[model samples]
Target: MTVSRRAGLLSAFLLPSVLTATTATGAALAQEGKPREVVSTISSGYFDDYLMLAVDGKAKTLSGYYNDGKCRFIFRDALSPTELYQRSELGEAYVVDSWDPDHPDRHFTTTLYSKTPNGYRNQLTLEPGSRDENRPKACRNRISLDRSSWVSESFYDVAVVRKRGARVFTIARAGEKPTPAPRKDRLPPPGTGVWIDRTYSAAFSPKGFVRLNWYDPPGTPHGGYVRQEDLYPSQPLPQRDGGDEAVQ
Candidate 1:
């Protein structure tokens, strides 16, 4: 998108009613206390000017909402209602580049803390670009999907194993049988590869499967899963100064 066009779009999005709560009461209502139970309902949107990852009809993850009213919350795993609030805090400090607003496809670099044998620790990711500038798109293909579509431009770099050993991996979609080695040229091809040095979020398995939502290469950005042994414990990344990687 052009600079001027991008600015106009951002201006429209930044308007109080669209991006945040204009009045204290609106903010207060949006920031209302968490729901009392795990009701299985999950929602996404602005609550009191803060973007939130809502659960059980309540706002669990909170932050400044942006990106054309669509904030993508990567589901790391299922947690108690209380633990959800604690993890959502990671999005509070997300600082995007001034020019990032131009590219609607980009997502903020989040600070992920994954569980490991030693305990929880921070992981690193590429810092988000400016909100006002054009940056390289995370999803190479520009195919547009609905806000609720499975396709995503960003990903959560989680691990299923640690550095203690190595294993071959066959990246497969959820419910699909694992193929030996699909092809290296494709995105997340089913292949046998060793763990790379990096840090990601904790493993979350619901329904007895390790799940993730991301942009499926050569197609839409959506959610998929792999075997538990496929992931690894990653090294931590240095924290950035400011950014709000909010949940949807």
Candidate 2:
């Protein structure tokens, strides 16, 4: 899709009213200090991602199931009622990315899910995460299902470098000049791949720039800003053998 078109769609999706309603609901639930359950389903063509969140206000815990068509992953985390409300207001929380070292293909760092007026929406993270040896062996399990009945477009947030000689800015302002990022930080040439957090993109869209992270050749993570015009949405590219290679 064209950048303009995508921007328009994103603007509508991130309307202030939608975010406010979600925050208000979460706040009310926390105030009640009672147990509650929230179920969210995202249909994407033949695959559907399902999540069921059960919050125990008194116990200060949150547990849920995250089904990604291929596997049913169990998620359990300790979070106070106040923290739960705060996380909901922020529109994201930490979830197990990967538990098995044998399956590198399934690795991911962050998981984004939020309640919206229509339903809950999730953005699949393409960036891989380190294997967690502490996680239980049962954290991931295969599932079989007929997915033909599901039908909806899936959107993954990936950013492709669209301009050459693009420099990373430690800080970016709409009208002000941008300050160059530290010399240690760098971005691959145009056509290389990167990704951004949807929440950050939406929050900074009005300013015409978004902050993102990229790894140096040695795999060190660095954060900086780039002009929104320098990027276009695209699917993640395949990683080369050996450790994670920045999409080239």
Candidate 3:
């Protein structure tokens, strides 16, 4: 479905990437005992903009796209630790909190590791909400991997639209458009209750414009199984958590 270019629907809804909480010190590594609240607020550069891909409500996720070596991530539209239990579209929650307050609050985390020559090679893990009892059983036995690729594009501005009903939106930039490649033999399993392996590529133009490209094999009922993911690029990691600045 084509989206409206109206600033309200497109720009307002483009969930801006920003810092969640705040870190005690701007200059320090995230260690135990004194973990800082990972804030992901927008900056002056591309890290300031963020985009959202809505799929039948419940803000799936949010984040900042890669622009320079200083890759920053933003996580907005947080679902209270309990909201995960009451869902509508994105199937059942696979990652849930262990209920232990001391832990990482059982939310989504954006981890960036050493990128290899082939695909993304970082270990990013997110635990479902504590009340998410409907998580897939396999989630207990093994970890569910929903991997996506990153490009030097500008997918930072996420446009939000408050529709009266649920709508499925495939969030992708102009270049990194969305594609269909799900199903029995497809790369990412596009189905509910199953771990869908997504392949997200990116692109950019000489004008310094960047966007995201996603592959959701199971699209909507009009075409595929429908509904999935809320994008988040401004997720916190070892870098770009607090407002720490480093010389490039």
For all candidates, the clash counts are: 35, 0, 46
Better of 1 and 3 by lDDT: 1
- Ranking the candidates on lDDT from highest down gives 2, 1, 3
* Cα lDDT tens digits for candidate 2, 1-248: 99999999999988987889999999998889864443334333221324333344443433333444443333333432111334455233333333222233444432334344433233322112325444334434222223232221211223456687676765445455444333444567754444343333443443666666544442455556677787643223333355322221
User: Is 1 or 2 the stronger prediction by TM-score?
Assistant: 2
Model 3: runs farther than 4 Å from truth? 1-76, 79-121, 129-131, 141-148, 156-212, 215-248
TM-scores of the models, in the order given: 0.21, 0.27, 0.22
Top TM-score model:
2
Query: How far off is residue 25 in model 1, in Å?
Result: 34
lDDT score, residue 37, model 1?
38
Where does candidate 2 clash, by residue pair? none
Comparing 1 with 2 on lDDT, the higher-scoring candidate is: 2
Model 3 over residues 1-248: C-alpha lDDT tens digits? 34555756666655452221234333343454452233222111111112121111223333322211222122333321211223312222222112211122434332221122221222222332223443322233222232333322223233211122223333334555544323332112211111112323442121212222333443211222223232211223233345322111
* Every model: Cα RMSD to truth: 21.6, 24.2, 24.4
